[model samples]
Target: MATATYPPPPPFYRLYKDYNENPKSIPEHPPPIEGTYMCFSGNYTTDDVLPSLEEQGVRQLYPKEPNVDFKKELGSLNRELQLHILELADVLVERPSQYARRVEDISLVFKNLHHLLNSLRPHQARATLIHVLELQTQRRKQAVDDIKSGEKSCRNFSWSLSEP
Candidate 1:
């Protein structure tokens, strides 16, 4: 079989290259991801401005995570995110200037993923607490059993010594 080669990714992806691995790197002060930086370094150039969330008019699709299965929804979103990422990267490579819409789609997917993961946080926390409590309870039971055995041994020794 012949080997296939691929081209490198567009420079635009550098903006969020670390986001999945280190979400904390996302700038906090700006609601819409605006920042002061050079034109080529993922920030917008002077003539072209990155749209704000207000400009995009973003709104909650649902007040809370719907009754749908979370794992399924999460999987769907993960795939959707990958698709949007590729679309954005491809557009940047081909049309460069026409990346605003693609960027918007990618950001929307990111927001959805963020929401889904957050909804699962409470459950993860509760599970961890339950596991710790269960382990602690097991340890306590073991300690009690050991103490009882020691008491029995002491009583047997006393009775044996007292027997004439």
Candidate 2:
């Protein structure tokens, strides 16, 4: 059977392109906290500057940012994963009739998942794995249902042709 290939999904490609074009900037200062607060001097309108203060406090109190770059790095990795999956989906759609190709695509997905989970901390990895598995299960079930429906329709058509 011939294998087919498709381009990345629209959203995935868009996100990938955006990431490629505009990589996130790691802030030199910490991100700002939302709300007003009081300082020893008096009532201080601490808007965004407090992130540095908060960061200093954290640094002084703790050994380090225990989850260093947790937000930014995970977010970037997630984008990469999304792009990979979208590419895989495109390939699978193109090669629907090729069992070997489908297998290869699925294996690639598992490998990606494995690598992603391994890259995360244990707690975070567990949470991410659960969500990813749920999504995969739902999509796979829908695909299976669609294939079954198509097969049934084909069978019905063949029967009708033989009868007439």
Candidate 3:
């Protein structure tokens, strides 16, 4: 009998790579505002929110079926949106010549979309923003520590060079 070789699991880094490489491959749903709404005084997951909209003849923008892991899925969606914004920013920053005007226009559109996504769920949006800020602060502190350690090593190296 011959042993079979299995392919390795896809890396987490490349989970979004396909979509990033060809965004158009993923069908674009209309913006969330196109959906119908039902006012609820209580908390609701994306699943809870979908039926009401569907009943009102509003198409659900999300490709996933209901009862999926809303929290994780929503996080992934938000992450994708943020990545899109960052990619646009990078393009804008890199092209200071002919693309400047185009960059400005796309950047403004990105900002509006980003703002709309964030505004959809106020509490969740605030929490996500806070989490991001905390992570950024931690990264900055680590960077500062690394620089200080490097400086100290350099200082010691110079002192040793000066001695004897």
Candidate 4:
């Protein structure tokens, strides 16, 4: 009787095991704080630097600027920034850079951004669903290739030896 040989473990098995063992091992960054603040001691007024400062969570500390509209500006700026990142992600996925050694990293970035957008805009659930489906399709193709390679190795081994 002959025993069937199994293929070696996949590269991602270690990652899967680590994830399953400690799902919370990844540290989460805090949500962005929105505030307006002064930049320089020159002629530039606080208003001149408020928008950029608020985007980075540096709001005015003085009571005189009590009416500062940081929240509104931050909301708009956050949305715009998110959209910009999404556009850049799309381009990267479409034509990955030759210097990128790990294409999966880029894919994960897109996946996270898609999730972020979905959470921010529940109305776009359908579009998010489509994006996830596409990612899954790509993963499926990679899995199929692995299986095919394993099968070829088994076939070659079986044909090379004589009956015992």
Which candidate leads in TM-score? 1
Candidate 1 lDDT by residue in tens digits, 72-163 = 77788788889888998999899999999988887887876676677677788899999999999999999999999999999999999999
TM-score of each: 0.51, 0.26, 0.29, 0.26
Q: Which ranges of candidate 2 are over 4 A from the true structure?
A: 1-59, 62-121
Candidate 1 achieves a global lDDT of 0.75
* Cα lDDT listed for each candidate: 0.75, 0.59, 0.61, 0.55
lDDT of 4 by residue, 1-164 (tens): 97659877887556556566788764566665455534585443333232333354443222224353544544544665566566667767786573253443444444433433433454366779999999999999999999999999989889877546
**Residue 53 displacement in candidate 2 (angstroms):** 16
Question: Given candidate 4, what's the lDDT at residue 112?
Answer: 38
Q: By the TM-score metric, which is better: model 2 or model 4?
A: 2
Q: List, residue by residue over 1-164, the lDDT tens digit for candidate 3.
A: 97559866667645456796787665556666433455686543444332333454443334435354545545755675676567667766786455565555545444444434543675687889999999999999999999999999999999999999
Rank the candidate models, highest TM-score first: 1, 3, 2, 4
Lowest lDDT block of 10, candidate 4:
44-53
Report clash pairs, candidate 3. none
- What candidate 1 gets wrong by more than 4 Å, as runs, is 1-65, 149-164
**Error in Å for residue 17 of model 2:** 45
List the candidate numbers ranked by lDDT, top first: 1, 3, 2, 4
